[model samples]
Target: MVTKKLYYQDQYIRNFTARLQKSGRDEQDRFYLVLDETAFYPTGGGQPHDTGTLNGMKVHDVEEIEGEIRHYIDVPAEVHKEYTGELDWDRRFDHMQQHMGQHILSAAFEEEYGYRTVSFHLGTETCSIDLEIEYLSDEEMSLVEKTANKVVMENRPVETRWVSEEELSNFPLRKEVSVSTDIRLVNIADFDYNGCGGTHPDSTGQVSSIKMLHWEKQKKKKIRVYFVCGIRVQKQLQKKHKVIQDLTDTLSAPQEELNETATRVLLLNKELEKKNNDLKMELIEYEADSYIEKANVQADRKIVREIFTNRPMPELQQLAKRITAKTDRILVLLINEKDDKLQLVCSRSEDAEINMNDLVNHVLPVINGKGGGNNSIAQGGGERTISAEQLMDELVDHVKKISGT
Candidate 1:
């Protein structure tokens, strides 16, 4: 026989007595108990299953499969035929508040705007509803939130009843019922009527309050609204307040002045960064000039070969550019040790006879790194199998041979 779902009869039923009609273990060796009647709400309709105790044994999960409701438990139930089930009221009531809140909020969207809810998910900490629309403006969201809270304030009775398919047309439903038989309708007084099997509170006010956290466009045309309700609203407020207080202390400004202070700080940081970059460039130019003056003259060609320990690649490039710009007669071959690897930068003055690409290509395999560039400049990095000095020596020796120096 199909197990009776007591939750549909009374959503507030926390404790109930039922006769243990069946007991067995699943493939995973998880013990399961089947009761003739139960208050446990199985996982369905986007709402998670109820978790509690059945005959002093922990009911970890409740699921309905093939018309049979199974209460998966931590251990085997008592050998007795009768069992007492106690629901975790906090989790159940929270879910009820969130589920009912969704109904009210969704109905408000439909009544005010033409937005239709395409999907709903009741997550662990928050819930979301995907609407069949591309976007929801801030003003439109505020209107829906206001309307939903108004319904909660009105404390309208939330009514649930099972009706046959023929009786469906009697009430205005938000959407058509999915089931032909045992059609359960959750009606919000004179506001909303829809087919649903999820548990809900008796009145909209019991939802406490609903808040729209945010919304984003999904799948190009749909809008997903993230929200929280009941106790979660207070929890969100507390978290935001804590963040505000921390920012106030960090910025040394009051909450009201936070926006202005943050903007000012960002602008100041940008200015400081620009100034620091200018100073770094000046130092790089000075260092590059020093290297150019120390270049070795071989066969009437100036070659500046240098090795830096643990230097960044960008700095090497910048130094090479500065050295070439200052003197067109100097060939630059630079190497640096960075991140446990060897990096090389080769550049030629416009008058130099060296081919940077050929030099880089010839040395890359020596250190197991790959790189490509034009004739004037080339760069690459590879494993630290060879020291920075070795890579620099290889490039210099190649340049010397090519220049016949």
Candidate 2:
């Protein structure tokens, strides 16, 4: 037998008694109990399922399986003739507020701008309504929010009625219903009429208020609007206020002056960063000149090889480039040791008769690393298995062998 949905009968039914019609375990061995009647709302249509206690056992999830509403739990319930099902009122009420608020905001958008809501998602923190239109400006969104809040303040009655296919033509439906039979429509005073199976409040005022947070364009010329309602709106406000208050204290400015203060600080930081970069470049040039002044000639090629402790790889590469640029007969082999890692840089002047990639290939295996480059410059490194001095010695010797002297 189908479980009688007591929630649709009376949305405020927190506690009820029902008979255990069936009980079994799924493929995953999760125990589930079906009842003759229940107030638990199953998960469907983007609204999450109701969670509460069934016969004192925690009901974590509820879903419809073959016309029966199964209350999935960790443990099976006691086989009593009459079982007690208690709804978690706080969670139920929060969902009610959000669902009802979505209806109002969606109707307002349609009523004002003809933007029909194509989708709705009731999330733990926020609710989103995907509209049929693509672009929605801030001012346009603000107007819709104002209209929705007006409906909430009006305290319009929220009514529901199940009508037949012939009776459907009598009312102004916002869109077509999903089911032809057992068609239920939620009516909001003289404003909105739409098909929905979700729970809602008795009046629009219970939704408290509707605030549009943001909106974005979707793939198919649709716009998704994110918003909060009732309790969530208050929570969102509190969170934002705390952030603003923290910023004011940190910047030593008032709330109204925080933006200006932040912009000024960012500009000052940019200027300081530019000056630091200029100083670093100046030091790199001086270091390059010192390395180039002392050179060893091997087979008529000036070889500049050095091992740097705790030096950056990029700076070493730049130094190698500077040295090679000064003379056509120069070959530069550089190794930098940073922390536990070692890096090597190899480069040569244009007229130098050697492919640098070959030198890098010979040394990469020694450090257990990988690298790739063209004939002009090649570099690679891995773990610091050996000291920078030892790595440099091996690299220079390989270059000497390539020189064939």
Candidate 3:
């Protein structure tokens, strides 16, 4: 059996001696080097593996398969022969700070609120824990963070031990014990205890601080809490300060008046929306009045046609429908400002024998466009290259011919 030294004693490991037992290629055509012994911790338990140089080669990843640790490296073959390994100390210590902080926070939650940490994930940016309880109020979370930081400030010694399977029954651990017969457990004095193989700070004080950022209800019985520790807490505070400064400058208000300024901006936007809607209704009403005044009154059938100006498509379409409701022999055209596009709508009277679809088909091609519609009511839109008056005249002439007037 290969002896993994780091698993039993994480603190004593600064450097180590190892032999390259074998080398092989993985499925991805990358080299995998096996060492007789290593201080590098293979990724497990939701915590990432340690990264450093192996034998003068950059160790990109470390993984465990069938109880043997394999190091994935990126270097030419000549360098691998002169191998000397180093661990990333700053990264390792940061992991230690975060893992230790989790123990204290998890313990405080159980002690204060009787909630258990059901699951946990240690991400590169932040760490999160899912609790058995459905929710935690902001005030309660503040108390929890305050209590955890108090433990850090007190600087309680953290102890690690190897216990036999039978010895595990004597100590009360926060999580279920899952490991081989030999178990490495970490204890935060009276505050917390758990079976963990991940590296941790020697004492609570080494963590420096703990900040619980937020929490959300995951389900009826689960709440996920997000937190940062040590250097991450400092970084988070800096980010929040920058955001507040930006808000104050953009709103042109004092820092204390930021919230009120934001509320006023939102209210002003709502008032503008209401006024815009009222203006649209007024334009639609005016277009309908103009269409009625322009109706042809000489023939047996009355025909009304008007080209609308200065209106959005939606308002113009509403106007067309209103005009059609007032008179059966009506044709409404609207031109959009941006692209100079035109929309046509025609309603036929029973006495008028006009096929609106055929009329639109003939007119659309003349303006390098395309359109289609039904017999009584037809509608289409096209580019406004031709003058709106010329287009309306062409449509009126076609309607008059089709109506035999």
Candidate 4:
């Protein structure tokens, strides 16, 4: 059985009475009803479906299946009876504005620069159209936007009518229709004429305004243009204004100077960071010199072992490197305790006999640690089941055993 599409008869039909002819569960186990007639718009042609209430039951999804529009609902309604259907007018009008705005915007590009829109999508927050060209400059997009808004402001009458295949040749259509028999055309005064099966406003002015948000390159030779229309444009502006106001309060700068002040502050931070790092390096060097003066002599090399509190592994490695670099035959072992974790760094001079990697490998297992390096340097960390001083005692004993002193 065929269901009469009430929307095509009158897009403004918000409330209607339709009797259900079929009702069943779909493959998804979703309960649905197929009415003898419906005003609900199904999901198709880049436009989403309409949602409302059927018999006061929330109709969450409306879809066309096998030439029938199914109104999917949360609860099943009485079958074979006339039920009141209410369309969410707010949502329906939003789609109408976006759909109409898209036609105008797409025509603007084709008219000005001969770029055809390859595809279109109507999203909840914004809509997009894919252009056939590989790139579109911001300046070009702005010009197209200006042209589209001009048409909108003109408030040109948008005409829609059914036409036969042979009759289609009579008008200057932007593109050919997909279906031949039940073909419909949407014409914007003298601007554009295209085949479409979506609901649209009677006048271009109802679109309110069209604003191009941004564009990015799609696949090989296509670019996707993102834009918003009507109330969406205002919502985008309000959100951005809130962010700017918060930033102005935090940075103590006017909106006009936010960018300049932010850039200057970032540069200042970088300079200060470099200065602090240089001071840290100088302090590490002084600590290294002090360790060298207190080192103990073993067989033929000096042993410098120290435990630190809340020190970083990088600084520990730098301190060990400085100590070994200043003397020819010295072994440097450093460990740092921060909270409950320990970090170890061991290194040796070019002539030192002990293999630092082997030494670290041998003792780190005691604290369930893990790390490895070359024969000269090694570092790793594990839990602090043992104190830093106890780990130091273990390292010194192993060094004596390795050196046979």
lDDT of 4 by residue, 1-405 (tens): 778899898898999998988999999999999999999999999999999998899999999987889999987768668989999998999999999999999999999999999899999999999999998998999999999999999999999999999998888888778896889899999999999989999999999999999999898799999999888889989998999999999899999999999999999999999999999989988988999999988778888988889987888888988888888899998899988888899999989977888999998888899999988889988889899999989899999887788
Name the better of 2 and 4 by TM-score: 2
Number of clashes recorded per candidate: 0, 0, 2, 0
**lDDT digits (tens) for residues 165-188 of candidate 3:** 888887888877887666888998
Q: Evaluate model 2: give its lDDT.
A: 0.89
Note the Cα lDDT for every prediction shown: 0.91, 0.89, 0.78, 0.92
Model 1 misplacement above 4 A: 1-3, 15-42, 52-65, 68-86, 298-301, 350-374, 397-405
| Better structure of 1 and 4 per TM-score | 1
* Residue 200's lDDT in candidate 1: 99
Best by TM-score: 2
Give residue 168's error in model 3 in angstroms: 0.7
TM-score of each model, paired residue for residue: 0.84, 0.89, 0.74, 0.78
| Model 2 / residue 145 / CA error / Å | 0.7
Order the candidate numbers by TM-score, best to worst.
Answer: 2, 1, 4, 3
Ranking under lDDT, best-scoring first? 4, 1, 2, 3
Whole-model lDDT for model 4 versus the true structure? Answer: 0.92
**What's every prediction's RMSD, in angstroms?**
3.5, 2.7, 6.0, 4.2
Whose lDDT is higher: candidate 1's or candidate 3's?
1
